[model samples]
Structures are given as C-alpha cells and as structure tokens.
Target: MFRFDWKMTLFVLLLLPVLIRLGYWQLEREAEKRDLQQLYEERQSSAPLPISGVDWSDKDIGWSRIQAEGYYETEYNFLLDNRIQSGQVGYEVLTPFRTDYGVLLINRGWIAAGPRREILPSIETPEDKAVIEATIYIPDGELMMFGEETLSGEQWPKRIQQVHLARMSEALGEKLIPARLRLSAGSAGELSIDWQTVNMQPEVHRGYAIQWFLMAAALVVLFVFFSFRRKEKPNE
Candidate 1:
C-alpha cells in the first residue's frame, strides 16, 4: 500500500533544512512559553496579596499585580499562511467575569477577521458578577498594522480578531482584569471554564515537538535511500 523511491529521498533531503528550521522555531517558541509559565507560577507563590487572598477591586484578577508583562500573540498571516483550520483568525477574544472566589478571564470566542480599522467588535460581557480565571499572554506582534486605539462610545458590531491586552485594558478603562479565562460554549449562556490552565498541559506541546522531529526524520530517511541507489551498468 506504500511505496518509497529515490526521487522521494531526494525530495526529502531538499526539504530537510526547511523542516528542521520549522521544528527549531516551534521548539524555541514552546520553550519560551514554558519559561514564562514557570516564572508566573513562581511570582504567584512569592508575590504579596492585598491582605485578602484576592483583589476584587480590579476589573480583572491576576495572580500577581495587574501590570503589563510580555506574552505571545499569534500573527494573523501566520495562521492563514500556514493554512490553519477555518475559524482560526485575527484575535482570541477574551472577556472577564466575577466569581465567588475571584475574577476569571474568559476567552469569549474568536473573531474571524480583523476588526474594522475604526471599529471594535461587539463582545457581550457577562453582566452578572463572577471571578475570572485565565493566563496572561503577550501577542507575537507580527504581520499586524495596529491602528490608533479606538475610543469608547463607538460601538460597531464588527469582529475584531486581534489581541493587545495592554491596549485592550485601556479601551476597557475599568481597572482592567489581570488574567484571562477560556470559556466553554454549551447549552446555556454559561461561561465554561477549566480550573487548570491549558498551557500547563505537557502533552500538547510534546506532541507538537514530536511532530516537528518526525518531519525532520522523514526527510533524512528519504535523503539516505536516494543517496545509496546504484546505477545500472552500460549495455554492451
């Protein structure tokens, strides 16, 4: 059912460098994220709280202070250029909600395209108070032409699929939530939640790491097979 040939080998070798480069990038990105997560966890442990375990005054809640810190944000073209699945586009829309314990950052949903140059997307924030939970992330800031910040009172129901938490915080104007929450869509209008942060999962990153390595391996095997092929003797 499967066939292997020298042409395949040559092709693989030719592509090996590209595959390796991509794998390296993924590894690097994942490593950077790991470091950030570790640092966040550490800060959470040593950081002082405001007498009470949680600070409800801020619009959002964060383990540490709700200050600007760097994180990863995916580029728009990177998503399309890579031919990612449909529905993956501009920004990962995040909203905040109050809770008994504290605030949580809920990833309300994804916007398909960039928000209009002069407009902001209509995000139905949860009016009912509840604590929000989410990890702080920074955007990659690639392939984007960020426009001047949009002022409040300009309500446009367009989709703004871009993330710039710092800028967003300004737009929001309330104390601004510290962390983010990834919401689950279900039967009712309830904000779905996962107590554990998604980035904490080793399996997801490991699986991706394995994929990049496998592609590199495949290329090498192909190159070797083609290199060893023997030529036929000339006919007398």
Candidate 2:
C-alpha cells in the first residue's frame, strides 16, 4: 500500500484561494472591457442626447486622501494617487453651472496657496459664472489618520495636502456632487492639466491578474510532474 504525503496535499490546498481570487479577477476584468466597449459603441451609434451630463465625470473620479505632494506641494492627488496636477491651496473654488436641463458642479480649478494662511491671493474669481463647457470630475476630500498631526474639519495656515474626502465634505458643509467639471483650456482662469496624474488603465490590472494566475498554474503543473516521475522510477 502507498502512503500519501499530507504536505503535498496541503501545498495544493493552499493554492485554492489564490486560484479563486485570480480567476474572479480575470473574469471581472473581461466584463469591464466589455462594458467600456459597449459604452463607447452606444456613444458612437446612438443619436446624441440633446442634453448631455458631464462626459468626463467618472473618467477623472479618483480615490482621495488629502495629503499634499510635489516640490512646492503645488499638486492635487486623485483616485488613490492615480493622477496629480499643479494647483494651489485655498477654498476648492467650486461654481454651479446651469446646463440646458439643470445645474451641475464645476470644479473651475484650484487656487494657488495664499501668501500666508489667511491672506487671500489676488487672482480674479470668475464673475460671469455661467455654464462654460467644462470637463466633469469628482474631488476627494481629506482622509482621517491616527496621529497627533491629524486634524479633521479644521482649516490650517500652511498648505494642507490630504486624501480625506469625508473631511473635505464636512469642511465644505455640503453634500458634494458625485462629479466635478474642469473648465476647458483657455476658459477663464484656465489652469494647466497635469496628464501625469491620470489613473492607471484597468488593463494594467488585468495583466497583473494574468501573471498571478500563470504562476499558480505553473506550480500545480510542477507538482503533478514530480509526483508522476516519482511513481515511475524504480525504488532504490
């Protein structure tokens, strides 16, 4: 009678979770690719809606935690550090725009940090404030941290870069719209767009998922190959 090794069985069993997780991830990624393809097709094939909501809304939505970064701390991080762009600290200057149908939030842009905490910058705020064609997005507020330096819902003197979306919402005292708009370039006070800050493509994740799955597959194959080779060899 042959004796079975529990260690080999345990090793194979441990691979289950990795297999399940990566298998699910691969499936989810395929679904996303299909969904995006369908969305693009609808946009192309269907008659355009006379009144369209911000197209760039979710495209720019990112994980937020308000931690300042950059040489001058002159950038805002979006979507879990997905994208960053040069903008200063101040009120996150928001403006309402009346579209053909209703109103929507427009993140006109960020203001440069004031000379000191309370000293407002001399930059001009848009006076005409109507619906200028804008790019849509969502702004993440500050993230809460467990430390002495962590302060929630309080204004600070120096530049306060952070990721706390909830804190930002509390400070603003408004249920922020799900999305914001970036005023088009050449629009009043048009700020530069930092392309480097865009979130990584979902495809990158799919590729990673594939690599993990392949590694798991290789392990299983090696296990089987060794087991069969041992059975075929003559006993010493």
Candidate 3:
C-alpha cells in the first residue's frame, strides 16, 4: 500500500499556485504585446496626419506619422546619454522646434560619443524654417533612476539620462509639447532612426508561459511518482 506524504503535498500545493500564476501572467503579457504590434502596424500603414491644434489633445497620437512646419531652436539642445548604435556609444540629439501651437521636442538624430565623458559632441541643427515629417513618440511611464534624476549642468547642450518633459519645459523656460518627434528619412538633421516600439514579441512571451506550465506539470508528475512508489524491502 502507498503512504501519503503530507509534507510533499503541502510543498506542492504552495508552489503550484505560484507557478500557475506566473504562467497566466506571461499569457496576459503576450496578449498585450500582440495588441500593441497590431496597433503599430495599422498606424504605420495609414497616411501621414498633419499636426494641428485640435489633434494635440489626442493621447493616442503617439506613433502616428505627422507633418509640421517649424523652425528648430538650435541654441538649447539635449543629448540623451547611454545611447549606443552599432556597438559604439552615442547620444540621441533632441532639439526643440517652435511650431504654431507650441514648442515640440524633435529627436533630430544620434551622434557618436566623444573621447571622454566630459567632452561633448558637436551637433548641427537645421538653420532655416522648414516642413518636417516625423513619427510622434511620446515618452511613457517614469524612468528608474539610479541616483539624481536630472543632469548636473547649466550649459547649452545639456546631457540627460532620461526624458522628463515637465522638468525640461521648466528648465528651457518654455512650455513644450509632451511628446517627441522621431525625424523621418531625408528629413533635415536626421540620423540613424532604427526605432523599436515593442521590445519582446508575443511569441516569446507565449514560450515563457509554456515553460512555466511545463515546470508545474513536471512538479506534479514527480510528486505523484515519489508518493506512490513501493518502498524497497528491508534485508533480514
């Protein structure tokens, strides 16, 4: 006859729920990623929309292709730190563009980092007023700060670790639009624009969910096998 191991049963009961929960969580993440990918594809396929005063209120305007006529404010610029391209350290140059409604931050492009951390790179902004085409990229959520949130400097080209629109607006002494425009190809002052909307694919999340579920199943099988196996006969 087989004997029940209450300790093993309790351990499995405790761990099974956690594993199952993790699997379900991954599945939820997969669904979210799938929806986001679909939305991105749909937006990219549509015609470019003009940036107007009425359209500014739409929160879902991010990632939408837009066109605007503005003059770039070359005096004050921001260098986004820790940006890497082709295995070389660089910074994404963000310049403010004064449009009819308000000033909008435009991510002009990327530039290679200088020899030392203290040395800043030279960024040339387009001089004349021009019509620009770009994709709107609204910064979402708060950044995880390891130390101070703002950069330590009061200079022309400020170096920043993360984008904080409110803080930046205050520093620049002008109210800027809450989003950034990623310069399109052939646009003035454009650089490498390999932007990724979704970091992980839905299939990857589904695979992780399957792994967690398999782990749970394996635990159940081992528990059953160990609990029911016949004990070895003792030598007389």
| Top lDDT model | 3
Once fitted onto the true fold, the runs of candidate 3 whose alpha carbons sit more than 4 angstroms away are 138-143, 232-236
lDDT of 3 at 138: 46
Error of 3 at 165 (Å): 0.6
State the lDDT of candidate 1 residue by residue for 1-236, as single tens digits. 23457677566767877877777776776776676567657755653443235544554343343221122121111111111225343444454343433333445444444345443333344343332223333333345656754434533231333544465555444344555434333411232223343233544566677798898887677566656656556982
On residues 1-236, what C-alpha lDDT tens digit does candidate 2 reach at each position? 34366798688789857776886787686666556545544543443222343333445322211111111111222212112344333444444344444444444455554567556444344444332444433332245646533334344322334444344344444444454445544555444433212233456657777777888888877777766664545766
Better of 1 and 3 by TM-score: 3
lDDT of every predicted structure (CA atoms): 0.45, 0.45, 0.84
lDDT of 2 at 144: 62
Instruction: Flag the better candidate by TM-score, 1 or 2.
Output: 2
Task: Report the number of the highest-TM-score candidate.
Answer: 3
Model 3: per-residue Cα lDDT over 1-236, one tens digit each: 66799999999999999999999999999998787777777987888887784377788877888888989998888999988888999999898988887888888778899999999998888889998888887443445878756644678799888888888888788898877778887887787777766667789889999999999999999998998888878872
The candidate 1 region of ten consecutive residues with least summed lDDT is 74-83
